[model samples]
Target chain A: MSTPALDATLAPAAGAADAATPGTARARTTAGLRGWAVRLGSLAVVVALWQWLTATDARVGLRFDRLPSPTEVAAEFGRQLGTGVYYLDLAQSMIRILTGFALAAVAGIALGVLVARSRWIGDLLLPPIEVVRPIPAIALVPIAILVFPTDEQGIVFITFAAAFFPIMVSTRHAVRALPTLWEDAVRTMGGGRAHVLWNVVLPGTLPGVFGGLSVGMGVAWICVISAEMISGEFGVGYRTWHAYTVVDYPAVLVGMASIGVLGWVTSASIELLGRRLTRWLPRGEGSAR
Target chain B: MSAPAAEAARVDAGLAIRLEGVSLGYGPHAVLDDLNLDIAPGEILVIVGPSGSGKSTVLRAIAGLLTPRAGRVLAEGVPVTGPSPDRAMVFQDDALLPWRTVRRNVELPLRIRGVPKRERRTAAESWIARVGLAGCEDRLPRELSGGMRQRVQLARSLAGTPRAVLMDEPFGALDAQTRGEMQRLLLDVLRDTLATVVFVTHDVDEALLLADRVVVLGRGGIGCVLSVPDPRTPDIDRAGLRARIIEEL
Candidate 1:
């Protein structure tokens, strides 16, 4: 039904060749494969350069004599996967992270709601927390060691400190940003303060709370690993530092890789849980991927 | 007109609302000054005016969602201090809980009243059906159209069978056709109920169509009170009255 002029206007621009083609399933698959190929190719090039640098002693002016080649690190990774000690270290790190993160989640949300909802509570509580919040978890090492009886508890405290602020700050903003009409509607329906909290405040603030949780999970991993490296006797972080001290460069790389994988998995899990809880929300255009 | 019109606005003992010398302001800015009005039980009183005329503020005062700087707002015989279950409000924006399904949102007032689960669910279902949302019970507010969401809000407000209903531009966002349909639907639904309604709108036609009496509010207080003669059939030239209201504004 289009006229010649309309057809001309509808035609794709000359430089937009990709846009001219329909975005069918096969096209999507090809695009996905291309993305993977590029990523794998970049990784392979890095590995080859690393292998070349350490294959012999004379490849470059800058020499890393203690650096382990990719092959040696891969071999050590396989051996570590076979050992019970490796599993124990991984489990220890997980236990500390989960325990600390759980404590932070509960306390953070409680404090956030209290501060946001009541002026008296905000005045009484916020000052000390604001002072404590700016200090980094790494900076708290000496004080934590002195306060806690064991290194394990000190590491857990560091992890908790890392996560607590993000969750608390985000939840406070979430509660404050709620539409007044929602509370008004509840109150006019004979709902008391408790009912308003249950029906309006809690559910309304969940998306922001989950955003905090995701960021907190990533930060928790960093704090726990750093704490373990400096003070702990048995964790992935401790194992990594111990390997470096003993000059087992391949083992150190293995430990680093383990920590990286663990952090990625935990952060992904938090995001997945957030998505499940907030299925009613329409996916924003910016969050398409 | 600056003085409180309390004596002239006095109503009988069975009046639904009485605003006596009510003055409201925000910081240094006054919104309503010495505003006096009254509504009898089972009447549809519409407050219509231009933007910034404090129409919605008056509704909020009656609903006890906002406190006035001076004077009293009495509902039945009780002086308004805070929101009560007997005075439900339909907000301009559909304030249905985004996480809750349509049925659950409508069931909220009953839940607050401590009605048992089975009874509240049944009551909510009946009201949803009355509002033409029976099949969409499980749909969240985000999934529904704006008109549909407004219907859910209306159903939620009426579910409690409140003694008074305060509405602030409840259908101001709907398309013209949908707005007309909703106005008709409101009348149909409230035909048998004896609830007093204080509906606020900028739409003169909507006021003439719905109100037993229309209170035209100016910058700070009442301009005039015009009776519709018969809301269902205005008998007078509706356009002429609309023009008169436009002039007053």
Candidate 2:
């Protein structure tokens, strides 16, 4: 919202220069391909480093020998992909993440708007949320188990607790940070309070909201996996812990890799959705990340 | 007469807006004090003043964006309690929604008024063309130049067919040439519509060029109100008017 005053002076000059430069399809495709190449290259380097370290049986001060080799982990990963149990665990974890994150999104945004728009709500609601928010999801494990009747509900509660704070805090700030002039503009155009909320506040806060959603998705994955490992019979985290207990080191690595991929995919989906929603905004350099 | 009928009759009257003894302040600091002004229908009233003279405050009050501490602001002969669609404002920053395209931004007023989609699109397109931004419909506000964004703001304010348009330093950020062109375009658009305009600017020359009546505002209220016999006609001494306005400021 704060397009600086200097930008007003400089943007026209830069925009005019861009207008002169022909944006050919070939050039655009080439740039996009280069972007993908860089991403893949970084991933490849990390994988190569992991493979080399495992092949060498690299020792870090005392105990790096316990890590499974890349080939061993890959073989276990392939074996897991062929089995029904691994697939079931994957599905269970994803369902928990999805349902919990969705619940958090709805409640966090609703409560955030209430607290932001009403001083009375802020006074009564914000203080309690603030106090509860600081207690980490891991710390709530005992309390969640005691409160919820089922283990599944307890894990879901932990996931929701993990994701809620980021979304709520971001939304409250986003709502508060809305430029007053946009509201005034809508009001002057004969828009009522409802119109202002629908057209101005909602849309104006979207970029910030999407930012929170992406962060919340990642946090949900983390907390859900942790909760599952601590108390669940199903899910990637529970299976990984079971594998470690049974001395199946490679299978543990496979579970860890699955969680990483799922978390990456969910966060990437959020970022893609955000881009689609805010396509009207100008994409500045270095903003792709 | 019934309440609705009486209200319609009042709107039909020649007087478009009136501010009487309007005083506003933030806590202890006073911005406007005892300001009184009347704007006739279809008249171009320009307010000029130095910084802190409350010119922008006057526009806000007239637009019903501000409630005066001591007095009343009337629109279409009715006391202004809050913002009404009959009034539109062009902010100094050209406050277009960043997430909306130029066409959608221009259509905002009509959309808010619940005008159907097809009609709103047609009206928005016409206003986009009117402001000489026809091809830039799908572009975001950030993609356009400062001058172009201001033109969009002008088109948007006029698109609503607002009875009274309030402008607050709308072109204060534009280059001199662009400002002149916008001023001409504004007058051209207003000539065909029955819109009452109240434009606030710090530029005295701009006020003189576009205003039917140039209001010189000081710390408290209007220090002087100078009428330009006709802005189109050059019968009045332009240099003298500029000098007088400069002296008043």
Candidate 3:
């Protein structure tokens, strides 16, 4: 990523020097393409090995009935895609994740800034946050169900719990990590406290807050899946649990694959948005994709 | 000597800045002690000292970034309680908002002052061209070299058109060649504007090259205030000025 940007920046100057130098640009493009091909090939090799093991007598116990072959999983996925159930589950999972993630991001950042900036608030609130952060969000499922009347609210709460701590911690750390000079610069420029917080402190904390968001999103998926397994009537997690009860190993594998793909796509989207928001940061290229 | 005498003198001369018995410290450590200085209109005073000599603290006090424990700071007969737009500061690090382009960075003070957009843009453009950043108006600070960034910072300070400018080692981070070029550029700009400037630097040659009056800060209080005889003229004997400053140091 850094190389591409550097190449782009130097390209105009390099072009002026030698218009006939096609070899250099071609070499870089080919190297990038080759890297991608290697990654794809490695993935294909893993699937082939899995298929070979499933076909052999070595596929026993957990491998025999509980786990499905790659071919079987793919066929089940294709079938589910045709029936439109896969898309529905995918959309449902996304809505839950996004709703929870957005809420966590908004609340976490605000609270994080408040705590980092104010000594009184930080002293009062930080201890509870630290204590609660260590407990797994999945463990709160039972308690959430007891408190909330509906299953959806409880599941969303679990997702929120999973994502909130990471974002808050990241935001607080980002705020703290800012150089005192940044604040001094603004203050000396005749900026008020509100102006300093809005302009300098907020922008400086964004990169770190996004880092927290990424970690929180991953955890949200884990807890969301666990929540669905316990009480959800719908979603990929629910479908996967249902498949497990019926001994439909291929469907279970399909569900797992769907979750993985959804998680990757959603996380990538968040990261992309983060890059756009922090386009001014010097180290932006690494996080752009 | 006496409070009434100092007040009467300031009223008569129209003092732009007056620091009376100012002392600054952090917890138990005293950085500056019992310092007195007066800056009149159109006066270009350069503070010279070694590292940890509290030259920066003096600038900070004037800029209202630091509050002195023992004395008062007055700007135009009014007490400087906090940072005000009347006195603009240029920091050593350039402190241009990395996200903003050169033009935007230079225009920030005017924007904060609630100047209309079209007027601010015109003002910003002129200052950008003045600082030799005419072609790089749309370029961000990160895209510019160290010297260019400092130039942008200088443009920003001048665009505000403040009553006084406080510059804290503004060219300290640049390479020797760039630093020399910047020093020359600053002198040219100041000569044209006639803006009262309080510049702080450790380099003896720099103080000699730019200042109308060089204040060598030793220990705490002002060591000496050596007036440069012929700074308004374009041609100056660089060697003679350096020798004079070296002797003072």
Candidate 4:
């Protein structure tokens, strides 16, 4: 690897990096690729084992034989991809989740900031929130049903309930954790309370708020599907439950697969957005490892 | 003769600060009792003391971040009810806004004071350059070393041209090598602004190196005030002065 040249050589950076040092930028990229390969390989192995167990009708510790085989589920997935109802269900579930999440995020942040800022607001608001926070969002399903006129609104409310607390709690903690020195610095600059809120409080709480957002998003997904199973008419969870009643195991598996894929995509986006917003955070040592 | 009178003997273009019977404590933990002190305009007054001696408490009182339980803290002939643009503070920790770039952090005071955007940029950039961070204005606070961050902070404190700069151990966190560089940098920058500086530190050497007058405070109250003959002049025989300050502490 003595074939090194300066950055002035204009050689491709990847090749130069690979040649210069073994554990630098190029090594990290290769390591990342290897990580992805391992993950995919592990997933494939799980699928293969499941197929073998179901195909052979093995009466193991668990009831693997009763479940649809991988090929049957794959074929069901292919059929679902061709249908308009499947697409409609996918879009419906997505819309409800997004609307609820957006509403929760807005309210959570405003209330979180308010509660963190003033003792009066904290005392006035915190008691009710604290009492309500202990109960799971899924438990709100019964209340959501009686309060809303439609199943759609009921499910959406449950989703909103699921997401709200994590965002609010995280944002509150973040605001509280801010060093008093930053506030002192701003105040000494002739800045009033509004100035500190705008300049210091808002941007400083972003990382914490994002942490709450990520957690809220995951919880929202969990409860939204559960609410759909209980009260929904058109979304994926309802459709999946509908398949299970008729004993179409392959369609049920397909529905589960769709939910898994959707959950992964949404959570990944939230995490990616968090990283983008907090680019200033030190990416800590040996992150690749 | 009193040190403040000697220090205030030559004054110009800076804020005159006088603490009249300033007694401060949080309820039962009485920090200072009827502490009467005067800091002359354009004077570099260094307050030296041990931990818990209320060295920082005094600076906070002047910056108006903390309210005095008793008496008045007057700046520029006006009572300091709260923090103002005339009295900016530099904290020991890099209080540079983590999210903003070096230039943006420096521009903050101007922005707060409602200065025009164009003027804010010019002032911020000049200060950033003056602090020898010319090409790194776009970098975030976390990206810079501790010394560089303090330099940014120094630039930030001096920006917007405040009448008085209240520094609470602004260089206390830096390494010895960086501390010396920052001291030199502060003196070089101090020449440009006539802001009355009330600096707080525990280091005896630091107190004599930068102060026209030094105030030593203890758990009870101010121990003594020393007037230096030509502050920051390296050739002066400051051994007696240093010995006196150490003895008082």
Candidate 5:
């Protein structure tokens, strides 16, 4: 009897209305617009500063006389965009990344789950993986060049190597870190080994696996570009290196800017995908209790 | 929002659980030794003990999650082996999977048993509503309050129509007021089924309120067993029983 009284007494105060009104909604929109303005404004300021320094050839502490101006880079960017070769390079680089990343995702997740699931497998496999993990994937360019017949394959291998360790390691940790309570709960309810794996281990590891994926994507980009620069006959990194050799300063600037955009876009996509996959996470359900 | 009146009460009289000279432990550390006990069908038996008294270990053995070092546990005259759907265990920590929505969590046991998808959904929603979570079918565990999460756990456990339910301080983590409500709600829910309950709690008051038989565990074994009178009777007094339980601790 007292239980109902306790709940009912608290219920009136607990039912806090959403409280959003016309005035607050307008305020929220204004705040959002202001936030975008600040972000875009910051980028515009940096571009304007760069343009001024290059156009005037300012040498406050370092010389900008040899660097390409914003207009020069923009014009070069437009010219490159019109050419079929530029698109080819873009496609080649993207294909290499996608192929390597896809292969790595499959293998890393499989091996990670395998090693984590069985103790003997972990003992046998983890030692060699840990040994190789610390060595930079870019540093493997020499071995890749020697072992692979084609530069394309070598670059892809490098990307795969760069991405594999992070994904594997994070997945392993995620699996091991899962709460035993879940497994026990399922088991008590007559769930078998497969059910435990499907219901608990895999879903529980998603957040950690995605965390590694985002990091692996970033690292793979780094190694792929370096591998291209070192050994590739084509691709964005190769083209950028070629521009440098030819002293096409504006083309080099265009390459650098394009790489920046590509990296940002890929990473942003990974994060968005990760967020969608783990939508059940509390997000910003604030406060500790 | 229909109450699953028929299926919810499907566990007719529950199973009789027996521990015959059972010795339970974890790898060289003995928690209970030569313990013998019998849990009556459809009875609420509460085990109260100080920390490390193996109250939970005993519950685990009956739930068939732990193997006794010596002797055996029998459920309905059959030797208990591995975990079975006939016995469901609820933990103090809300063990609802964080990734699963309320409906899916409630549907897990049914799904494991190969129950049809449509029927499982209907059963899950029925239990969800019966537990007073009518509109929270899609909410994740993390989105719910602690008390609400416990309610979901209760629904999830009972939805399976288990013969015996083992609860390990299921409301120990709640605030005082919420704990009281949960206790009330548990009694209300139990009225719908004849499942045997082995509730382990540190709170003596909780045991007195819920149990037909209160077993006090101490020194790695049963210290005493007290029978709680129906509190609804205006003339019966059990103050001495409460004091004995407190003194045994």
Candidate 6:
């Protein structure tokens, strides 16, 4: 009934500590470091289990043979890095994914805002999006190849197709879900429609839009890989497919590791950007988790 | 403050708000019918009634958030069309943007009005300090307690410098002590400004504590308007006012 009283009581203790000395800041930093160490220790245990499975002779149909050990994959990565072809392929793959992702983000957000604000646009465009959204991005590979002249264009198209729907749908939902009072508040303050869109509606929808972008990036990676494996001249996905054809299981594992790391880095970058843009957002671990 | 000037600007002037033969309905069912009331300028008018007594609807009509099927709403002799800068509302939920710091939240109306940045920031900072959030200007709304957030909301509405303020159970979500402090703060703020206030509340004590004239609504129209014999002050007896309102109810 009176949580403010409890908070008021606790506030003084924190204020006292803050005023006492600067050492409290260092102490908090070290405590955060300790938390990170615990998380890393658990990750090490998982790596140890993987190593043990690979070192032992497993009798399953495709245990260590098909799924190469971490060490084996690492060695393959080292050799590939020395040749520098792997880096080139990695760069090409990243460019394709990023370019397609950027295009999707722009187009999706624009269309989403349009549909959310106007009923006529929503009626005209929403049905087509809903009808096609359920069809997998991978399934678009064949269609992309038929529609585009080159393999590169086809793969990029597939990646774009993968990311666009999620971002669009999420943006639309976010726009619609904004509190009606916010718009009224802006209007009362003499803001026009354009001003409201730029200042209030866009900022209000960022959290949800970024949520969609994160998911879209993950799916974009999947589709990019599948598209490359099907028809790419040279890419991580193509190399992985080639390794499988030649029975080079270690090389295949290395490719999978490369894809995973790339996906993680890209997604994390987008998340960081989101946080920077929404700096006014309240502190909570719920969004990150 | 000069009582002569205050009376000339408030009591001596005609009604600031007039709702005449107002009827409102949603599709089929009428919520308010044949309602009429007049609130003097610079007066704190509290509307108290049962759950579905259209107390809030009257405020909504005045704010132009809702339209009445019949009759008219006027503010300062001008017909109310929609939400305007002349009237500001403090919602029940505080409604401070979670992403904005206290200072930024208070500056929202100014920013929308395209007020110069330096002037807006100074105004916002002054109000932040006014509401007792001086040291926490950079803190987000989530970082503040419920009472602090509500204080920020009040500061935001005040920053606009509207002719009148509409508060729809603004302290209804707060605890008893916090609510009391807020009521006192509201009185303090009202004393310093000429903004006419239309407060809607179900709490009899709250109605008595903050209002100069308490208007009770029964089914649709005004049941009664009780003028407090004593002017609003920090030391008013809540128990005495509550007994008076309960008897009327």
Task: Give the Å shift of residue A282 in candidate 1.
Answer: 3.4
DockQ of 3: 0.53
Deviation in Å, model 5, residue A189 alpha carbon: 1.4
Q: Candidate 1's C-alpha lDDT?
A: 0.87
lDDT of 3 by residue, A1-289 (tens): 2345445555665554445677776775678679878978999999988887776735454465335789888888889989877778777778888888889989899889989999999999999998898999999988999999999999899999999999999999999998777677667667788878976899878889999999999999998888889998889999999999998989999999889988888787777778678777776442322
Which residue runs does candidate 2 get wrong by more than 4 Å?
A: A1-60, A285-289, B1-15, B234-236
Please estimate how well model 3 matches the true structure, expressed as its whole-model Cα lDDT.
Answer: 0.83
Pairs with backbone N, CA or C atoms under 3 Å apart (clashes), candidate 5 = none
Cα lDDT tens digits, model 2, A1-289, are: 1223334444555555556764644465467568768978999998888888877878878455778878889898998889999999999999999999999999988787778889999999988898998898879999999999999999999999999999988889999998898889989998887988889888888888888898899889989999999999999999999999999999998998899999988887787677778766666642411
lDDT of 5 by residue, A22-130 (tens): 5655565577568768978999999999999998999989999899999999999999999999988888888998888888888898899889999999999988998
By TM-score, the better pick of 4 and 5 is 4
- Model 4 ranges with Cα > 4 A deviation: A1-19, A22-34, A286-289, B1-12
Predicted complex 4: CAPRI docking category: medium
TM score of chain A per candidate: 0.86, 0.84, 0.88, 0.89, 0.90, 0.86
Q: Let me know the TM-score candidate 3 reaches against the reference structure.
A: 0.90
Estimate, for each residue in B1-249, the C-alpha lDDT of model 5 and write its tens digit: 365778545545688999999999999989889999999999999999988899999999998889999999999999999999999999888599988999999999999999999999999999999989999998889889999999999999998889999999999999999999999889989987889999999999888888899999998599888888784233466788889999988
A95: Cα error in model 3, Å: 1.1
Candidate 6: tens digits of C-alpha lDDT, residues B26-134: 7888998988888888888999988888887888888887888999998877888887766788878747776678888889888877789999999999998888778
DockQ of 2: 0.72
**Clashes per prediction?**
0, 1, 0, 0, 0, 1
Best by TM-score: 4
Which candidate has the top score in DockQ? 5
lDDT of 5: 0.88
**Alpha-carbon TM-score of each model against the true structure:** 0.89, 0.89, 0.90, 0.91, 0.89, 0.83
Please provide, for model 1 over B54-125, each residue's C-alpha lDDT reduced to its tens digit, 9 standing for 90 to 100: 998898888888899999999886899999888999998758888899999999999999999999999999
Off by over 4 Å in 3: A1-20, A60-66, A283-289, B1-15, B232-248
lDDT of 6 by residue, A13-105 (tens): 555666676588557547756876887898999988888778885656756634678888789889988987798889989999998999999
